[model samples]
Target: MRPMLNIAIRIIRNIGNIIIKNYEIQNINSDYNEYNINLFTKKINKNLNNMITKVIYNIYTKNITFLCKKKFFIFKYKKTIWIINPLDGVMNFFKKLPHFSISIAICIKGKTEISLVYDPLKNDLFTAIRGQNAQLNGYKLRCDKYFQKKNLLFALNTSYIFFTKKKNVNLINLFVENLISLRISGSISLDLAYLAANKIDCYLNNNVQNFNYLLAGELIIKESGGLITDFIGNCNYKNSTNILAGNADIIKLVISKIK
Candidate 1:
């Protein structure tokens, strides 16, 4: 586990350097090289997948399956499954918003065993192992259980607004009106990570199509004493599941407002 952590740190640091350097260049030629950001992201994604494959192979002799954005590689034995999101917030990356991250999780028979999410710009690494407390950097983290409407901060991902029903939008608006504030960050992984660290008290996502997006943060929040469930408060992971994550009391507050 230590070796894996070391490798992950190294990988993210290298990738962060690449992104920062490219972003500097993009700023100088923003008008002319708008499309270059996409190319840069593609290069980074390719390098990340290749590097992870080599690193994992060297660490374990057992067959492993690797899943990432638009690419899935399967090795024969499948004792472990590695799920990764090399660049989580590509849109933010292209916009040079500094809100993107790298997410990685190891699952055994569909249950996550280890999870990691790295924010390159902030150098924040959130990690959790099943049955162990979640950590930011090296310090243990736990969610805040207090549910105060006057002081609560809710992180929301409103990307699903186009597809969401009117009732759902009304429910979201209810939260907006009642909570102290509502934040919409484009990165779902970071939103969940922030929730686990108590930087935000709650997170709601209506369009999490892939488990890869939430897998790492899910474990982190859970190990940090946060509760995550579908819109109706069921602990099921599926493509259609709308994510609601926070401490137990906040989760109940969110569930109660869903119409």
Candidate 2:
């Protein structure tokens, strides 16, 4: 497992380098037009997937399977499953906002074993190996300490509003009126990582179709002493994208209101 984790770290760094290089070059030749931006994303996603597939297949052989979004592949061999999202927050990155990240999660035998969320721009790496706890760069990470509910920073994402759970609509409205500070950032993966790092205390996102983006952050939250549950407080978060995450106390409060 340690060897696999090391390999994953190496792969993530390699991907980051490519992302940084491309981002800088895009700036020099930056185009805010819709058509060019779409083309740029398509080209980078293809290249990154090729690199990841080559690296994983060469080392792990046929035993590794992938569940990558934007690009999907499933092999007969299924001992190790890799959920890789080459770039999270595509909008932010292309728009010159430095808030996107690259995340990878490895699930072997039906359980997540390792997770890594790397912020290429800042060179910040958030990682966790099951039961060993979570870390940022090398220091351990934990959710923020309990505080007055209003003071807790909230990372609320509503981009996929169309997919919103009708029942939880009240919860969203409630938070806006109740919570002291709220942030509607574009990146869900980074929001989850920030929750685990104590930078944000509560994160609620609705209707995000990319499960690839949630894989690593879900494990990161658990390993860092945070809880993740659906809007109704059920553990079946994987089946749906309506997630409510934070420390136990905050989650309980949110759920009480939702219920």
Candidate 3:
């Protein structure tokens, strides 16, 4: 396959088409010029998050693979894979419900290195580097801890957990009780990006794709002054059945409870 990145671009184009065809077409918001690019050579950074699915990309490889998630596209690259969930909340968008997005990231050598998540409906993008800052559109972003709710928003993949053995139910409920609010967004990539943006306090994944598929947001949270690790508190992001990510304080507390 051409490589994950290339597939991501094609997927973005497809999503953009869907959005423009579905909603009123408009010009690109003049918010961030430095973050604008429709090519793969463009600098990959946090600011690229907003234009999540309108980009046309090429990943320098032979053969290409594409997969669609509800209304998104995922691709495969050489020694890497690109997964893009375009239109994360399609149901909400079709119903004029609320926030929806397009998420794209690349996993290289089993680690997340590049990510570009955009909300096509809002034309907002969030980009990130492995060890650098994350940006919203073009402005640097840091996950703020000003949330005062005693039960800060907690996100989980409940649908995926329903099939789990009953033995894990206690652990699930224990985690649930710690948060002030809980949500089940159907998009995993968006869930992690939301954490980087401080929209949510913590997120846990029970059974997701390979670790490489998660590195982009994993590194984003770390770069944005957050924390990430498996159930055992190990920082390894390469191979794990589950992951806990959030701000440093939240991750520590959540990890302590899991132990």
Candidate 4:
């Protein structure tokens, strides 16, 4: 990475910290109400989004290539492409619930070479480099959660089985019977963030398309003591049509049961 790129990333990280703290303080003052809290949260998101856009424009005008989800822009040069998610859990933040996040990744030829997932709610940041250990807030994180599995708390996205041509009712029933509990949180980004914090044990949702899944899945979970793969146990990020994420043992057990 070039020195300028590193400096830009550092600036982005700093701005994220400030925004998270500001939102948290705002929520505290709003008594956790939707009306007032959401307005402030939207303002914060817009501010961050604008800053990111400026950075992207600067990089692009200089002939850099990039990819983005909405306005979370990433600049690419040569074989490297950056993936960014400016606001992960917009609804949660809007409702004064503390679970949203910011995710960024540097992919070299479609493989993540460097990545950062930051949850402003808990002030948790997970960072990783290819072929090296992942870290959570600078502390080494490992995907070992044997004890968490016995009483699993899972998170998933809600969608119809219409696309699958298979009824999910029976599968849902089976999973409910084995798992301790399940939650349908509106945001996949927050779901991964919660998993990293141990607020949730695992996350699985087969209906997710490549668009959203590619951003948050590995940025947070894989970097914070968790694993991610398709339902059939394939680790390829883009090939994962059906996703499963959790601590190693928890993910393995869930995959076995679901398959």
lDDT of each: 0.75, 0.80, 0.61, 0.65
Q: Which is superior by lDDT, 1 or 4?
A: 1
Best by TM-score: 2
Instruction: Sort the predicted structures by TM-score, highest score first.
Output: 2, 1, 4, 3
- State the displacement of the C-alpha of residue 202, model 3, in Å, after optimal TM-score superposition: 0.4
Candidate 1 similarity to native, TM-score: 0.86
34 in model 3: Cα distance from truth in Å? Answer: 41
Native-referenced Cα lDDT, model 3: 0.61
lDDT of 3 at 86: 48
After superposition, the stretches of candidate 3 with alpha carbons farther than 4 Å from their true spots are 1-14, 23-81, 90-97, 107-110, 145-149, 160-179, 209-215
Query: Which sections of candidate 2 miss by over 4 Å?
Result: 27-34, 62-77, 160-173, 176-179
lDDT of 1 by residue, 133-190 (tens): 8999999998987777777787878575723677686576666588557788878789
Candidate topping lDDT: 2
Question: Any idea what lDDT model 2 has?
Answer: 0.80
lDDT of 2 at 45: 74
What shift in Å separates residue 51 of candidate 4 from its native position after superposition?
2.8
lDDT (tens digit, per residue) of candidate 4 on 1-259: 4444364457458667756667566544436556765576567656766776676666557667545445456677777676677666666655667666777767778677676667666667766665565667777766556564457777777665523555455457556677567787766765776676677887777776645435644755666557788777788745645777888777777666666
Candidate 3 residue-wise lDDT at 96: 49
